[model samples]
Target: MNDSLQVIPLRHVDAERMMELISALVSSAGSGQAQGGNNQLKVIADTSSDRLLVKGSPEMIAKVQEMVNQLDTTPTRRLSGLRVFRLKYASAGHIADMLRGLLANQSINSAGATSTLESASLNDASSTGAAINNAASDSLGSSAAAVSTSSTSGTSTGVGGRPFSIIADETQNAVIVNAAPELMFEIEDAVNQLDSRRAQVLIQAAIVEVSGDDATQLGVQWALGNANSGYGVVNFNNVGASATTLAAAALAGTSTAGISAAASSIAGALIGIGDSRKDSQGNTEFYGAILQALDSSTSANLLSMPSILTLDNEKASILVGQNVPFVTGSFTTSGNNSNNPFQTIDRQDIGINLNVIPHIGDNGTVRLEVSQEVSSVVPGSTGNASGLITNKSLINTTILADDQQTIALGGLMRDNTTTRQQKVPGLGNVPIIGRLFRSDNDSTQKSNLIIFLQPTILRDGGAVASVTERKFNQMRVLQLVIDKNGTIKQLPLSGTEGWSGNVSADYELMPLNPLIPKRDQAPKSTSQGFTRVDSPNSGITTYPLNR
Candidate 1:
């Protein structure tokens, strides 16, 4: 590492802010306004006296400076003229890798030698011998079956095995590589590439408890089946399992006519009494398994429970009245809530404190505290509402309250709107130069800003499992760009340089697809269900999902 190699970490907020600045810079640079004209607001030749002065949008620079400032509690002198490397825009693979790693490490101990790092890139990486050896035999066979046993001696390129190499340029601080796998496969392979002997040694060094559905059931299954194929197991297929289903006779409301009529209004009010199974004919079977468990008098009583620190007796009484049983870990023990309303799961596996109030006799009724800084107030026409509204701001306001899946950055013909605020650069805001450069210029759009960052080192302080890099410098603007407005617009970051759509297609990253499926619920039409057809070659039933 070089002595001047400055390191920086960016949070969600910093990324957003940096993006605003980059967009502004790109817009300004593309516009002819950046040229030295009568519009006194021309671009600045320089900002600081540093020989290697770094320049970027104000928000981008500010965010980087802010992190450095906060982390610098040391007696080091004030740092200045530092080049800002802003990682504003990231690919889907990047985002997915980050989220996956964060969610994967949430539960259990992540402090030992076996513990993985919290950061990763989403690009496919080259495969090593150990990685190929770690994959499940099925998945491995699905990819490269020619891979045979790796040798324990020198060179180790035995029969049927592929000799992969990762060349690190110690002089240039870069890596040269041949073809690499996709990001998802890279992550899958990297973990599998570790030496079993080395892994066991590290596991022994760190007495960490690795327990969970993924780490236990899936882990054991994958580990046991393919000792030669080293790999991690991840699955979300728990759709039709018998252990969790209920019986029809156990259903509460499907009984006698006269007695059923009397209980008709509240018949379906019992818990664990829902249709648990769905047949091929589309019929559902609800059982009373959950309801029976709750009706028993000897079962755990809510009255015997003590009130939580954040909840008063009034709130605690509601839990008893509602007869709501605590539900804990579902997807995995790592993301479980232990049925406590006061704790909600975070992507990082940490529990965030929350105050929940349930409605009487309702299992789904829940009202979480919206206010981080809660206060008390009265309610009336001229007075305060029943509850105080005080100063409360929500995080990630970019996402809708009803559904967080949608994005709301801007619309076409975007004018001065409160929602579509563009971040400007500090130097671009100077008196004479400010007017010449608007952060949202849309004339020339061929320029692009590149960003780079140091890779994450694992906690074990050993070699990283995987690596990825993007050619940000190669990013070129296209003549036609779909702006936030959803309309085609042209823009430049510095001046009147416009993109002519002449950019080579080879420079573009892979086209992206919608992360989530277009529709959530099955279509009302029966034809929307799976269609079973006899195999052309074999007489077997096969159901293909509706495309």
Candidate 2:
């Protein structure tokens, strides 16, 4: 057999179905011609572009082509036309129901065939009954035809047709119909008549005070009900960190340079928190981490510290302080044997350093790392020599959160401010009998800083509206009142005698208000209680305020 390659182009057929058909043909041919071997025939289908390539002996290629031709010639139902229409704000189920109602009893002509209206009607009734029964059975989970009939009789008022199929494509937000050309036109008309106007989705965000007298100063209040849209809000709090011991170790016989170097390293780590890149929301992973760490604290002692204010001339620093030991030695010249003074060493200063780094994830998760170091000098037992004590703590973690969701990082407790009052500079230092000339006052303000982060995911109006409507229905009426005016008021009703009391009095006996016109000049009252009056000179129409 001579080797040959052939390409077959197919149209009006799904590539997937074509591939399956070819596979079946190959299997059958292979069984009949076992001598050809399993690999004798090779077929490649480029489903991406919908084409089939065959490589084999000429005999095999010809056999494949014959099968394709036969398959192509087989008769099948042909769609006269197709119409695709979007349901917009409508659901697929609703469009399906509408189509069922509009297209019921419509005649469907098969390919190269026709049907009379009478026959179509008869078929429609049977098909309608079957469809209703099927729907009822599926919904009710009952097999009894009588049950289905009774359940559907009230709801299934329209006839059904077998000539067309309605397909709801939810992903595409559209409905597609396959029917005769005339039927397609009718479907299009019916769909156009359905309401497709989409409602607006409104998303709102605010930082609200959950509690405290200062709550009013915090979040912005909004009336979302009056607007015909949906709404959402996100609340976030400040970020904070707690002071925790990072490391505790004694440093003896270690050079001062070595201790200083370690302190510098720890400081670098803490200050490096600012190196993280900010996300679209202008938040860095470091900040997020800090917020998370602060939030995870279970004890008040582990809370974050309040922020400090620095004067313009002074620079703010995260490296709080580092204390180094001082050493001195002296010789005594006048004592017996001209001996040196007793050698002694004293160490008392402590050192502390803190560092925090936060990393933000793409999915709004935050990873935080915190490093702290503390050091102190301990006196040696033998002489004036001193040893160093150091402590360090490090934390790293990740947390997941979305918009309107709050993540607590940490808390801080400290004296936020100090106030000092003194008399005139010269008199402030007076003592004893001079006490009357001087006065002094000192005060410390303590505060706790908590970090709260709330993220709000902004979405398209459609989605926002849908969510807002479904979740905030109760607010709608309230919003209307809010929109009318910033406040709600109750006004006294006029002409309430009949409503307040059981008796109705004649107008002739009732006292007239000086502000109102006389009864004869007033507009005639209609049965509906509205009085329309016309001015002959001004040609202006007026109505009485009181019904």
Candidate 3:
């Protein structure tokens, strides 16, 4: 064995692949020379920069050089300035896996001339019959398989696979991939197919929660769903309140009879309750009984209670009385109470008034002015005239685009109801006698009302036409002159006209009637105020006299 080492310089061979080959060769030489002597091949590789250096015994150096030479003989292609195609809607991992699959498929079609990194390492190691090196190669192949499985399964952290790097350059709005040029062409083809398809615009929607009573909620839902109202698509969801809370609010003057009515209607609709041929009076009695039972009992308990006939008119009236004062001969005197009588009596009523002003601008701005007024009879008060609660709200604002602007039309009242029921302690439990022993009382109150407003800008044909007209008005006009012959002529009256010479300068004037005689050639006038003229250049001249 020689004591001196040999150095081999390799070119065009990947440093990583060269190092793996050298390590395998050194392992083989070490194991093969272990039993014979202490002389073993020492292999060291310097892979910094582009050059790869390998130092080992002559035989080991010869083996590595042979592998490099074999690699150099294989067919290879080079490409530059190739762009990486990216799918806007696809993820990076998805693109990476697709490229990996494409490479694998192409390798298979080419009879495996281009082997995977793991397989190549295994083949190079197995070429030499060294037990330790073969075992190491097997272990390396297993680890590589595990890593490839993890990467293909979409668990790798970086942009692309281990073999190449795929990066997204947001500044250029493109992706850059470093890989074999031939494979990049395949990727470009796939990406071109993706780009040929059209992209879709997605609509983003939101779910809004509106807190209100049944009537107001139904009205808003209907308005939003109506096509003629121009509010686009809207969906309504009903998440019912707890029965205990609903009943408590109803009984505590915080909820209205409308709520109970709505709940009953919903319950009846759900259960398929049908109307029968019952008289109006009988129907009234049926509803009255239901209300009475529901007033004192829970909704669940009301189902178990037996139905009964009850009369509940639920009518209310008001009376006003006042003492009168009499005036006799401009002197006031107090009148007797018996002589005075009640003057006026009227039922309480609710009044609502609405006013709105909308100003639309040519610049796509909208200004809105809204006013709302509400008046209702106050609860737990005497006399219908003086127990009125009036509320008003005014809003003025400007909004842009199709964005929604909400104005709180508050101060409108929500009817609050208090339900009171009187019943015998034990007899109310009786099936037939319960109706006579139980009575229901209900009172009313008022709470705040909330309103939501969403305004949308309608850019119809007229608006578009106006915008186009404004744009047209902003354009500048270029002046030009046209001649009688239907040809455009340049300014300054150039060529063949008397004013052609230096248009900026003044020209000599010419007489309209140059044939007329001059003052020196004309004859002098006589005492009769008549004169005759003759000129050598003129043909004839005449004069007329006036009386």
TM-score of each: 0.13, 0.27, 0.20
Task: List ranges where model 2 is wrong by over 4 Å.
Answer: 14-16, 29-40, 57-59, 70-414, 424-428, 453-547
Q: Write the per-residue lDDT of candidate 3 for residues 43-90, one digit (tens) a residue.
A: 555655323554445665577667667753323444452455545644
Report the C-alpha lDDT of model 1 over 1-547, residue by residue, as the tens digit: 1112122333212333443443455456563234443222212212121111223444434543554455323222212211111122222232223322322221223322112322212133441111111111222224322222233321223223322222222223222222112122333333233211111000000011111111101100000111233322211111111112222122223344532342232211233222334446544443322221111111111112112212211122112111112223234334555743343332211111112221211232222222111111112322432322221111211111111111222212212212111223573466765432222211111211111111111222132221111111113233223333455443445221322323222111211222334243232212233333344533322222322
Clashes of each: 47, 40, 0
User: Which 10-residue window of candidate 1 scores lowest in summed lDDT?
Assistant: 199-208
- lDDT (Cα atoms) of all candidates against the true structure: 0.25, 0.39, 0.35
**Model 2 lDDT per residue over 66-126, tens place:** 8776765323434445566767666654565455434543223322111211111113322
Q: Which candidate number would show the highest lDDT if scored against the true structure? A: 2
Flag the better candidate by TM-score, 1 or 2. 2
